[model samples]
Target: MWFRRDLRLGDNPALLAAAADGAEVVPLFVVDPTFATAGTPRRALLHDCLVALDTSLRETGGIGLVIRHGDPGDVVPAIADELDATSVVVSRDYAPYGRRRDAGVADSLADHDRTLRGVGSPYAVDPGQVRKGDGDTYSVFTPFSKVWRRTGWQHPHPAPGDDVRWVGAGSTGVVSDPLGERPVAGCTLPEAGEGAALDRWRRFIDTSGASDGSSRSAVAAYDDLRDRPDLTGTSRLSPDLKWGTVHPRTLLADLDASGSGEEGHTVFSSELAWRDFYADVLFRQPHSAWENLNPKLDTIEVDTGKQGEEKFARWCAGNTGFGIVDAGMRQLLATGWMHNRVRMITASFLVKDLHLPWQWGARWFMDHLVDGDLASNNHGWQWAAGTGTDAAPYFRVFNPTLQQERYDPDGAYVERWVEDPSEPMLDHRVERTEALRRLKAVTGR
Candidate 1:
C-alpha cells in the first residue's frame, strides 16, 4: 500500500482494499527530496504523522512503514521490484505534481507487469464530480455549493476484515528512527493514526454540545464567530483534513445526522466545498499555481525590485507598520497557521500594499503552514489578486486600517502579536492616507 496524504487507516479506501486483498502489504512512504527542499514547518508535522503511522502498523503485527528517501518515481518502482509485488494501490491525488508523479510510477510499474489501482479520493465529492446540468464546471460558489450538497457520497467503509492474511515483504535491513525520538520545537500536533482521528472526532461531537440540540443550530452561529480571530469559533480541523487524518465524507455524514438547519449547515458545508472547488480549478489549470488565474490580468503590475523585495521581507518578518497585518504574519510564523479572515487581509496587503506578486506570498505560505495545500494556497492567492474565478475584484482593495477597526475593533487580535502594541494611533487616519497613497503609486492603480 502506498501512503500519500491519506495517512490514517480507518475510512481509508485504498488502505482498506489493500489489506483486504490479502497481500503481504509492504506499507511504503517515500520521503521525496522535493518535499524537503520546500522546507515548510508542515514537513516536520508530516514526519511526525509518519512516526505515528509506523506505530499503528507495528501494533497490527506488520513490518511497520518502509521509509525510502528518493524521487518517488524512481523509488516506488524499485521498491515494488524488490518486493516482487503484484500490484500497487493508493488513494487518488489531484494536485498537478501528484498527478504527474503517480503517472510516472504507474508507467514504471506496468513495465514490471504489475497493476496500479487507484481508489477514490478522501473527499466526499471529488473535484469536478459535482457540475452544472450541462456538464460544465460551476465557476460561482453558491451554485456549485448547491449541487455539492445534493450530490451523493459514499458511506464510510469499515476497517479491513481480519480474515485477510499478510504476506510480509522480507527484511530490507533498513531501520528508521523511532517516532518518540523526533524533535520538534513547541509543536503540539494532534495524535497520528486512525484511532487518534476517531477519538478526536468523538471528543469534539460529544463534548462540544453541538450534537445535543440540533446540528444546524450548533454551526449556525459559525458564520458570525468564524470571523472573530480571538475566538475558537471555527472547527480546528483543517490540519486533520489536509493530512487526510479524517475523511471529508465522515465529517459530512456526522453533519447530516446532526439535523442542523439549512442555513448554518449550508455555510459550514460551503467551506468544505471550497476545498474541492480549488482542487478542480488547479487540476484543470496547473499554470495558475504560479501565474494569474485570469490571463487578461497577467499584465497586472507588481514591484520586484530591491525596494519591493525589502518590503516583502518586512511583511514576511512581521514588521509591517500595520498592526493587524503584522499580527497575522506573526501568527503564521509562530503557529504555522492563520485564520481565514486574516489570510485575506494579509494577502491583500502583500499584493496591494507591497505590490508583490501573489506567487511570492503563496510560496511563503507553502513553506510554513501545516495546512498549506497547493490548490487552496494558489487559488487563494489568485483570488486575492483578483485574477481567479469568483475572485474579489482588483479595485476592491482591503484598507488595513479600516479592516482592523472593523474586525479587530478592540485591537485584541492585533495586540496579541504586535510588538509593544498600543491603541490605534490618534493620527492613524493621516498615516492610513499616506499608506494608501504609497500603495497606489507602487501598484500604479
Candidate 2:
C-alpha cells in the first residue's frame, strides 16, 4: 500500500483492498522533494503523521513502513520489482501534480508487468464523479451540492481485520528532516497523527459509542457557534482531513451514527461538500489551480511593484493594523490555521483593501496552512477575490473592521493574536471605493 495523504490505517479503503489481496502487503511512503518543500508547517505535521503511521503499523500489523525519497516513478517500480509484487495499490489522487505523478508511476509499473491500482480516495465522493443531469461539471456550489447529496456516498471501507499478515516493512528509516522543525515563532499546532485526530473528533461529538445516535451533544451546537471565532466552536479537523488521518467518509458515517437530522450536522456535511466541490472544479480544470476561473477579473489592475511588495510584506507579517485582518493574518502566520470567517475577511482585505492580487495571498496561505489543499486554498482565494466560479460578487467587498465588530463581538480573538499591531496600513473605505472602481474598469458588468 502506497501512502500519500492517507496516513492512517483505519477506514482506509486502499489498505484494506491491499490486505484483501492476501498476506504480506508492503506499506510504503515516498517523500517527494516538491511536496516536502511546499511549506514548513505541513512539512512538520506530515513528518509527525508519518511517525504515527509507522508506530501504528508496527503495533498493529508488526510490519515496517518503507520510507523512500526522490521520484516515486522510479522508487515505486524499483520497490515493486525488488519485492516481485504483482500490483501496487493506493488511494486515488485528484490534485493535478499527484495525478500526473501517479500516472507516471503506473506506466513504470506496467513496464515491469506490474499494475498500479487505485481504490477509493481521500474524499467521501471522489472528484470527477458528481455532475449535473446534463453530465457537465457544476461550477456553482449550491446546485452541485444538491446533486452531490442526491448522489450520496458509499459507507467507509472497514480497517484491516485482525490477524492480517504483513511483509517488507522494517528496512529503511523514515525521513528525519522535514522542511522546518519549528512552527511559526509563537504559533501552537495541535497534537499530530491518527490518535490525536480521533481524540479531537470524539471531544467534538462529546459522546462515545459504536452505535448511539441520540447521545450527541457537541455537534448540536455547531451551527450556533461555528461562526464565532472567539469561542472553540469549529471542529478543528481540517488539518487532519488534509492529512487523511481521518477520512471524510468516516466523519460522515459518525455524524450519521450520531443522528443526521440536526441543522449542525447538515451544515457541517455541506462544508465537506464544499471541499469536494473545489476538488472537482480543479480536477476538471487543472489550470484553475493558478489562473482565474472567471476571466472578467483578469484585466483588473493590482497594486504590484515595490509599493505593493511592501504592503504585501506587512500583510504577511500580520502588520496590516485592521484589527480583524491583523488578527487573522497573525493567526495564520503564528499557527498554520485561521478561522473560516476570518479567512474570508483577511482574503478580502488583501485583494480589495490592499489592492494586491489574490494569488499573492493564496501563495502565502499555501505556504503557511497545515491544511492547505491547493484546490480549496486557490479556489477559496478566488471566491473572495470575485474571480472564481460562483464566487462572492465583486461589489461585495468585505469590511474587515465591521467583520471584527460582528464576529469578534468581544474582541477576544483579535486581542489573542494581535498583541501589538502596527498602524492601519490603509483606509478601508478608500480602498473599498478604489476596488469597486478597478472592478468597474475591468468588467463594467
Candidate 3:
C-alpha cells in the first residue's frame, strides 16, 4: 500500500483494499524531495509519523515500511517492478500537486502493466460527490454543508486484517530516508503517529466540563467554548487529520455514535463538513488555490511595497501589538500550532488591518503551521480577506481590539503567549476605516 496523507493502519480503506487484492502488501512511503518546501514543522511531523508507522509495521506484520526517495512517478513504479507486484493501491489525493503526481505515477505504473487503484480519500465525502439539484457546486458554505450532511457517509472500513503480510520484507534494501533526519525548525511538535493520535483522541473524548467550566469534550461544550482559545475548546486533531493519522470517517463514526443530534456534536460535525467543503472547492477549481473565487475582489488595492512588508513581518513575529494576533503567531512559532479562534484573528489583521495580500500571509502560514493543508490555509486566508468561495463579505473585517475584548475577555490567552507585548503596529480603528474604504472603492457600492 502506498501511503501519502493517509498514514495510520486503522480504518484505512486503501490499506484494506490492497490487502484484499493481494496476500501480501508492501507498505511504501516515498520521501519526494519535490515537496521539500512543505515547511519545517510539517516535515518534522511527517518524519515522526513515519518512524511511528515503521514501528507499527514491524510489530504487527513482522516487516518495515519501505523507504524510497525520488520523484514518486519514478520511485513507486521502480519499487513495484522490483517486487514484481501486480498492482499499486493508494488513497485518493485531491490537492492539485498531489492529483498531478498521482496521475504521473499511474501512467508510469501502466507502462509496466501494473494497475494503480485509488480507494478512499482524506475526506468524509469525496469532492464532486455532493452537488445541487442542477448539478452545480455550491459557492456558499451553508448550502454546501447541508447537502454534505444529507449525502451521508459510508461506514469506516476496518484496518488491514491480521493475515496480510509484507511483500518486500527482507529482499528490499533501504537507503536515503528523510524521516531519519530531524527537521531544522526545532519547535517542539505535537505528538506524532497513529498511537499518539488515538491516545489524544481518547483524552479528547474523555475530557469533561471543568470546575471553571473551561475544558470540555468534543461533543459536550464545543458549541459554547470553541471560540474561547483559553479553554482548549477546539479539537487539536487538525494535524492528525492533515496527516490522516485518523481518518475523518473514523472520527465521524465516533461522533455519530456519541449522538449527532446534540448541538455541540452537530456543530462539530458541521466543522468537519466545512473541511470537506473547502477540499471540494479546491479540487474543482484548482486555480482558486491562488486566485480569488470571486474575481471582483481582485480590484481591492493590496499593499505589497516595503512598508506593507514591515507591517506583515511584525504580524508574523507576533509583534503586531494587538494582544490576540501576537499571541496566535507566537503560539504557532513556539508549538507549531495555534488555536483556530486566534488563527482567524491573526489572519484578519494581516489582510484587513495590515492591508497585505492574503496569499502572502497564506504562504507564510504554510511555511510555519504543522497542520497547514493548502486548501484549508489558503481558503481560510481568503475567507478572512473576502476573496474565496463561501467568503465573508468584504466589509466584514475583524476589529482586532474588539476580538481581543470579546474572545480574550480574561486576557489569559494573550498573557500566555505575549510576554513582552509591543504597541499596536497600526491603529485598529484607522486601518478598519481604510480597509472599508478600499472595499467600497473596489465593489463600487
Separate clash counts for every candidate: 4, 1, 0
TM-score of 3: 0.96
Residues 98-132 of candidate 2: C-alpha lDDT, one tens digit per residue: 99999999999999899999998888789988977
lDDT tens digits, residue span 1-445, model 3: 8999988999998898888844578888999987687899999898888888888888888787888888998899998887788889999999999999999989999998998999989999999888999899887899998889888888888767678866544435533344557677658888899989988777666656422355656556778778887777777899999999998888778775333466777888888988999999999999999998889988799899999888888888888888999999999999888888888888888888889999988998899999999989988888988888655777888888888889888999899999998887778889989999998898886
**Per-candidate RMSD, Å:** 3.9, 3.6, 1.9
Tens-place lDDT digits, model 1, residues 33-114: 6875553567777777787777776666465777777898998898788778788889999888999999999999999998
**Candidate 3 colliding pairs:** none
Question: What would you estimate as the lDDT of candidate 3?
Answer: 0.84
Question: Quick one: best TM-score, which candidate?
Answer: 3
What order do you get sorting by TM-score, best first?
Answer: 3, 2, 1
Residue 112 miss distance in model 2 (angstroms): 1.2
Comparing candidate 2 with candidate 3, which one achieves the higher TM-score?
3
Those runs of model 2 whose alpha carbons end farther than 4 Å from true positions after fitting are 171-186, 207-216, 257-260
